[model samples]
Target chain A: MGQYIHLIFPLVIGWGFAFAVIALSHFLGPKKNLKTDLTPYECGVEVVDLPSSKNRFDIRFYLVAILFLVFDLEVIFLFPFAYIFKSVATVSPFLMIEMGVFIAILLVGLFYVWKKDVLIW
Target chain B: MFGWIYIALCSLLVMFAILMVSARRPISSAVFLVLTLIGIGVLYLMMNAPLVATLQWLVYAGAIMVLFVFVVMLFQLRELNPTSISTHPGRFALLLLLGGGFLGLCLKGVIVGLQEQPVIMMGQTLVTGEASLKDFSLLLFSKHVFAFELLSVVLLATLVGAILLARRKQRVS
Candidate 1:
């Protein structure tokens, strides 16, 4: 409905170009096999650990992720509020208090999480 | 042309949703669900609601799904055994009932909203630069202020509850 065609236009072009290059290489490029060539990239350094499913991530990883999500959600909600703040403020100063209440609650959550030592390794 | 994209997005959403439910692997299910979320965002974009779409992308698809992946990794959960999942008929029945109830509620809301479109249009006409957003904020703060305040309380409870749940309980000597 809108002129959002520009948004996807570059995306379509990029994908088409990528696939074209990949296909061209597959057809025309040499398929020689070498041990060094097949080796996994190591950032020009020695590879540390080969990735496998046997290693389990620490629980703290998930905990940190959850905390990140909670605060991330708080930020996202603030976007709409911030977007219309000036106009809303002009209408009624009470509008600011509404957002203040929301932020205060999240700040409480942050304090709770902090006191609980959830952020510690 | 836009209609075709909308159809494609809807089909993608439904397909990924099905994949999310039916996939045996936890990782695959999370991935499929993320795809479904992206499809929903794209649909929102097509509908010219960039704010909602961006919010969906940032919060739901990005943050929430990142957390889900971490959860899946924490569990190190691989393929779900079909026999183990499907064997519990009672749980299955309960799930079916709950899903049906939720679906019915959604359908009812959609029908009611359609019938009340004219009333909603009064608020709809204010679509402009930031006036639409300001209008929404005013409506939310003025009309739904109580509910908004309640939401903060709910978040506070959830925060406390989550911390309590996550904390290691001390053992009695």
Candidate 2:
């Protein structure tokens, strides 16, 4: 618990700096209420679809995100095994088999995705 | 005191969660959800599970939030107008009751835990709740090995399901 006390300094300083910057700009900066100023600047181009809803993106972006999430969770689960692999292996040789099985399962998923051409796009 | 810090983090988490659900814009809601996840990660750190906290931030706040934002952008949802929200008093009351009951159960568990005496091991009180990375690894790889392996299978299913659902259907021969 005490070890984490030092982390408080960075958090405090970071948030303080952010709030200070925003506060300073709000209080000191020029306040022009022009309609042009309120609009989003897009290299002086006319804004289109700024307020319109239901813009559809390519489905592939969502697929990539899903793939990333699956692999990310797999990595997180591997962390504990990697941390204690040696110690646990000394107790029994089955630890290796256990991790192998885990990876094998995920590998099948990866193989399935590869075969399905999900990663091509 | 740690208790004060814990309470502050819990309240902050609750505030962010409320903001997440109530925010009009999908992007704002996603951002608030990230803040709520970060607050939970900090709470995990305070509880002496640094590894869990790091994973919480990495998996939930980082990867999951990325997915959330991507989905939001994919849908390209605009702000929800307040007038468009239909109110149902019965549904609201039911939700309130469910939330309150869950909160009460959690508070009761906390109260019971605080009332319990600390375990004395060899005449020295053991730090009961401290879960360093080494301790976490020992438990995960030994007694919980079955559950750990099962988690991988779940991930595999999720991966295949996600890919199958997201990918365009193949043309039939």
Candidate 3:
């Protein structure tokens, strides 16, 4: 725990920098209390047909999100494999084969998605 | 000092979790859930498992949260009326009973473990360094390689299911 205490320094610096930037912009930026400027759609254009909040999104978006999540998990699994690659490779001959099989299984899915034209849009 | 920080973090996580469940808006609930995940990731860091903590942040807080928020947006649920959620008192009571029983069992286990000081790493010895990671990776690659490969198959199944369900159907030519 003591060894990891230094990690908190980056967190402090990051939050401090973010707050500083926000504070500087709020105080330094020019401000005008104009009703026209407060409108939802600015640039002297009246609001067009506003999209309703109740509108359901296309299923394609959700599909993309699901794909992203699955691939993100794949990356997570790969991280540990990469960490102990050298040491494990020396000890076991099947190390590369294990990782190859893992990736190959996922690659089958990738190919299936590609053939189904899921990646086109 | 670490204990104090851990206690504070746990409290923060509990607050976020309650807010996540009770929030009126699903989007707000998702945001609060993201906060809870981050707090859990911090807890992992406190446990001296940086790799696990980083994975928790990346997989749970980042990618999984994005998926959850996307799901919230996928549905047209701008206004969530509290009364609209159907509640069955009998089912609720049953669930409460089951959950309470599980919690009690967990507490019993903890108390028993504390009473019997087993040969296990508790505090300082729990520091997970490169050696521990290597040990884990070796086990994963050697003994648990089948499970690892099986996970890839699970991911593939998920991908295929998503595309099959969501893909736009083409009319016969």
Q: What is the TM-score of chain A alone in each candidate?
A: 0.71, 0.77, 0.79
TM-score of 3: 0.78
Model 2, residue A114: displacement in angstroms?
1.9
Pairs with backbone N, CA or C atoms under 3 Å apart (clashes), candidate 1: none
True contacts kept of each: 0.57, 0.80, 0.78
Tens-digit lDDT track of model 1 for B57-149: 998989999989888877778676774443555645555554555455546555665666355332232354355556665676778889877
Cα lDDT tens digits, model 2, B57-161, are 999999999999988878877777653322434545554554565466557656764666744212231343333567877878778988888888888889878
The TM-scores, one per candidate, come to 0.70, 0.74, 0.78
lDDT of 3 by residue, B62-134 (tens): 9988988988877856756663322334544554554455455546655665666554423465544777777
List where candidate 3 sits over 4 angstroms from the true fold.
A28-30, A42-44, A50-56, B74-76, B82-128, B171-173
Interface RMSD of candidate 2, in Å, is: 5.3
Angstrom error of the Cα, residue A109, model 3: value is 0.2
In candidate 2, how many Å is residue B146 off? 2.1
Candidate closest to the true structure, highest DockQ: 2
True contacts kept of 1: 0.57
Winner of 1 and 2 under TM-score: 2
DockQ of 2: 0.55
Interface DockQ of each model: 0.37, 0.55, 0.47
Task: Order the candidates by DockQ, highest first.
Answer: 2, 3, 1
Write the candidate numbers in order of decreasing TM-score.
3, 2, 1
